[model samples]
Target chain A: MDAMYQALLAPFIDFAFMQRALAGSLLLSLASCPVGVFLMVRRMSLTGDAMAHGILPGAAAGFLLFGLQIVPMTIGGLIAGMVVALGSGAVARFTVQKEDASMAAFYLISLAVGVLIVSLRGSSVDLMHVLFGTVLALNDAALTLIGLISVVTLVALAIFWRALVAECMDPLFLRSVSKLGTPVHFIFLALVVLNLVGGFQALGTLLSVGLMMLPAAAARFWTVRVEPMCLLATAIGMSSCVSGLLLSYHFSLPSGPAIILSAGVVYLASILIGSRGVLSTRNRPSRHRTA
Target chain B: MAEACITFSDLTLGYNNHPAVHHLTGTVAKGSLTAIVGANGSGKSTLMKGIVGVLKPISGKVAVKSGNRIAYLPQQSELDRSFPARVVDLVSLGLWPRRGLLGRYRPEDCDAVSRALVAVGLAGFEKRPIDTLSGGQLQRALFARVLVQDADLILLDEPFNAIDMKTLSDLIALIKRWHQESRTILVVAHDFDLVREHFPQALLLARQPVAWGDARKTLAPENLLRARQFHEAWDETAPWCGPDDAHSHHHDGEHHHHHDHAPDAIHKGAA
Candidate 1:
């Protein structure tokens, strides 16, 4: 128990890595909260997942092509993520097919494409780092990059938030009321792509979206106001990151999974405790069924 | 001389290049209460959309008198009432156009929101999460948002849908008060009786407009036949049904919309 306390509490006193991860996570949570709020309202949480995993190919391409340069690889990954988002949005708008189906189709194709290219080239250790991430290798430069990306994302979100909400609530009405609907939608999609790319070094392709989604989902059970909900989501994300980091350190487990599992715990807990908690469903008012 | 609040000159409303409403002309007076009515696929919603600028007409001009802010309420089917927003939060969105980024609302804005809530008969629901409200209350909450906008040009699509009759009566009373306050209102209604009793004027539209003017004259039997025919949508050349899939469609048969730019064309027609 004492040793456990030391690992959880002592790390703050000495290790800069732990401090950086905590700070990074806090900042990241702040950044992602607004994004998550909109994603839930827009019913695009899964889309975030697609974008998160969708960047793998570009990351792989950059590393293999440039021999592991951070800038080239990140740039490739960003572009790839955006392409997947924009393409999916366009396809859904134009076709009769559902957006979720389109997203899944693209996600699998992107992963397969990345894998195929990596295997065919026989030179992909750098690519794996991008795909699975290198949380332990989150040196000062990586932290700095993550911090900058998070700051940029939050600032943009703060400015465009009202328009974003209006658009999400009613695109047809919002388009009529404001002339910026198209711009707002594209800007939001771009932000999602950027955040997924920013978390690439720490969260990896498979896990980054979980952090984005689960904390926000957990926070939804607590409030209806956008501002409060967003703030709570950020706090949840930060706490998940800290606890996951501590648990990861103590157990020598993968930091990403620890964080995701922590977030999942919160989500399940909220679901159980929300008005229709598992045992309370019979007594609860039935949810209004939407067409 | 001042221009009419809205003016449509040889306007065509459509989604793609095709037009659902072709060669349409009209105008709306300031402080007028206008009703738009038609059958399913009659392009009633499309016309409202066109007026508000949600959809762009292919080859028509819809011009609005400048500097007139607008408050719009879309069809109920389009909104997700399950969101966590409260009645206050939903209404406050109306104030967004007034405040710039980083601009906080002054006390007066808050007062306006309160007044709007009261107007919609949602006086005590300032902090009520949207989900707690019944269908009628939800409509009222949305209407409160429009009041917060306090805009001179108010456009509502299917405002009375999914509500009990008492709530519909309450909404009509609220709309009447707004009209008395000198705001021009364009309401899309599915029920024929609501428009005849409350509005002095109406535009009966199908794939194209069958008639426009005093509600009694516009809803006359001969025009009603045209409205039904236009609504049944036998013709492809109408400007309201634009060739593109995303642009024009019918919802509850009372409005026409062009996908790219509905506002400009609608004002022209409204005028």
Candidate 2:
């Protein structure tokens, strides 16, 4: 027992980097998991995925200009994400193309452009760092950025909670009563962009949305209500971060991928054993009966 | 005469500059209960969209009485039924115009939501997720939300589709109560029998005004025939004609106007 405890706890307790990685991951999860729930319920999960990939080119551009500075990369990621979101939306609106098709086209182009830019000036090591993230090497500046973004995301979400839900449920009804429809939608997208930007530094552009969407999708199997689902998703996200960090510390695994794989494991477990999960039918009352 | 709550002056409503409803002129009096009856593609929903400011008129004017709050119940297909929201929370959104975006919900607001749920026979369903409710029950829940809204003008678009008869009569009673309160209510309905029995005024439309007045007169068999015929005669290949040119389609003799603009003639030389 003592050997197991020491192996599991010592690295986090002794190494400051592991502690920072855990804290940074927790903060990112806390802010973004609820946004993920909204995205899932709004059927924008793919949109979230597209936005995550869309941030890569911007972050890569920032990397090309400023190496690996946190602020420039964050700003670059934010601009790229917003441009993709708004651009795809505009393309869908003006042309016959659907939103998902437009988003797919934009994100594929963004990923290619981002990779080309990184390869143009930087080496394979820099490309791996940007694409896969360096969770264990988070500095104080990165920690502060994550903390600041978490606070802002939570605050904005609280203020716009009612409008966001209403907009998602019945936009036409909302439009008839009030004029907050468009503003709420844009603000919600901005929140998604901000969280993606924050998550990019810690989880990398490719896997950042995993910290959001995986826990959210997992939480859906546990509860039907919005508030509980959000709370459960947050808890699931935090747990995944801690467990993934410890696993990466013990084994020689990549931190970001380990964290996402941890979330994936939880999601798979939830799908099998959660209250409303597929394998939980024995515990659940039958949904159909003879008339 | 009662004051006009809504005045449509040659309003042309459409999509991509192609008018679905053209040269519409009428008035919905304050405290009137009016039914807008039309065939499937005859622009009933489009006109409602115009009135609610969701769609702009292609030309002319739709002058709603200023400062009068509007409540609209669109088709169930338009709602995101899978959204995760409790009946109480969804109903409380009716207070949006009053509370704006971030106002606190007082105890009275809670009481109002409860009262509305009771009014719609959904008192105990406050905690139920909207997705769990039956079709009739969902319509009832939406009506509860509209009750909480307390708007002066209420527009209902096909509010009775797929609902049970019990729910239908109950909703109609609520509509009557709103009518008694002197609110202007406009419903887009397919059932002419229901309109004649309940609605005092009617606007029978088929891309244009077939008749608008007393339900008994406006919903006569002759007018209903005209509406159906007009809808059937609509030129799918008609060139994109603006509101100015649409006037030529409606001649003084209704019979002649219907026969003159054959589908082929409508498609040719209107650009």
Candidate 3:
């Protein structure tokens, strides 16, 4: 039992950075995994992944302007993400390009611009830091930013819960009765961007959305309702974060990839063994009901 | 005539500046049950979208009477049934207009939802996820939502498409009940026989209005033929017709008489 405690709890208790990283990641997963569930339900998981890439340049610009400060990088990342998200949507609307195509174009450009910007003034180590993240290096400001953003996201989601669900199920019906649909959609997109920005500080731009989407996709096998799916995804995300942090501490693996890989494992397990999953369905008796 | 619930003043609606339904000018009277009949791609769906404010007008205006709430059901094909939501969750969205974004739902609202579900023969389906529902049950659930919406103007786009006979009859009965409640109801449908049997008024469309009046008169065999010809005559490169051309060709349809063809001509040709 003591050995298990040493393996599980010692690193977090012994090191301040580990505790900070765990706290920040926990808060982030709590907020973002639920948002990821919304993204999955709306068929926008790929869009979420694309927008995470889009956040890189703004964060890189912030790193350039203010070194590695959390506030500047967050603000810059948010601005860049919103620009790409809104700009891609506008481009899809006005031009002949579809949303997926425009998002792909914009995110690719953002990724290229971001890597170039980061590599201009800093070493390869700095580029790695920007791309893969350093959860172990989290400070007070980073922890606070993650915590605050998580709270704000949760509150906004609660307020817009009805509108969001209504929009997803039947957008035309929502629009005809009230003018809440478009604004609610924009607000939901902004929340997604905000969560990605908050998550990027710990998980990095590329892997942050993995935390958002993977657990959401995994949760699909466990439940068939939105609220439960959200709760289950958040729980799955938290577990991955904890296990990933421990794996990174003990096995000396990269934290971001470790976390995402843990989420992937959960997703795989869900597909195989979850109550409503593929394997379970395949194995169930094909008995007809006598009505 | 009853007061106008909706007015389209030379309304033209379409995508990318290409008119799908153009040169439409009419009033749907309050408490009127009107069937919008058209051939495939004849802008029946587009007209419904324009009325519900989904597709913006290209050149004209669609105005709903002030203080009249609108409830719209797009085609079933347009809905994502795979969405993770319970029947109760979908139906409760009807309270959005009454409750706004942040208002609390009173017990009476809950009761209203329950009553609506019962009315639609889905009394015990409150907790069932919408994804688990069969097509007919899903359609019934959607109807329950519309019932809870309690709107003054209800527009149903192809509501009967792919629906089984029993479900179709149940939904039709619901529409009839809504008509009895004096709601302005516009239905987009292809079954001319159903329209003639149930709806008092109809508008036959073919990108442009071919006829609009009594169901029997508007769906006259000659009008359906003209509608078909107009649909086929659509020129991709043609510019918007001038106002003089619009006035000359457009028909208010109430005065036009075809004394020769019998009304059952629809059962023979269109139905």
Q: How many clashes (backbone N, Cα, C below 3 Å) per candidate?
A: 46, 0, 0
- In CAPRI terms, model 1 is classed as acceptable
How do the candidates score on chain B by TM-score? 0.82, 0.89, 0.89
lDDT of 3 by residue, B191-226 (tens): 999999999888888887777778998898988888
Lowest lDDT 10-residue stretch of candidate 1 chain B: B245-254
Task: Please tell me which model should have the higher lDDT, number 1 or number 2.
Answer: 2
Best-matching candidate per DockQ: 2
Itemize residue pairs with steric clashes in candidate 2.
none
Off by over 4 Å in 3: A93-96, B16-18, B250-271
Q: Taking the tens digit of each residue's C-alpha lDDT, what string does model 1 give over B24-95?
A: 665777778889888876677777777777667776677777988888787744666776777787788778
Model 3, residue A17: displacement in angstroms?
A: 2.0
Candidate 3 CAPRI category:
medium
By DockQ, the candidates rank as 2, 3, 1
Off by over 4 Å in 2: A1-9, A93-96, A282-291, B231-271
What does the lDDT read for residue A47 in candidate 1? 86
Reference-based TM-score, model 2: 0.92
| lDDT score of residue B54 within candidate 2 | 84
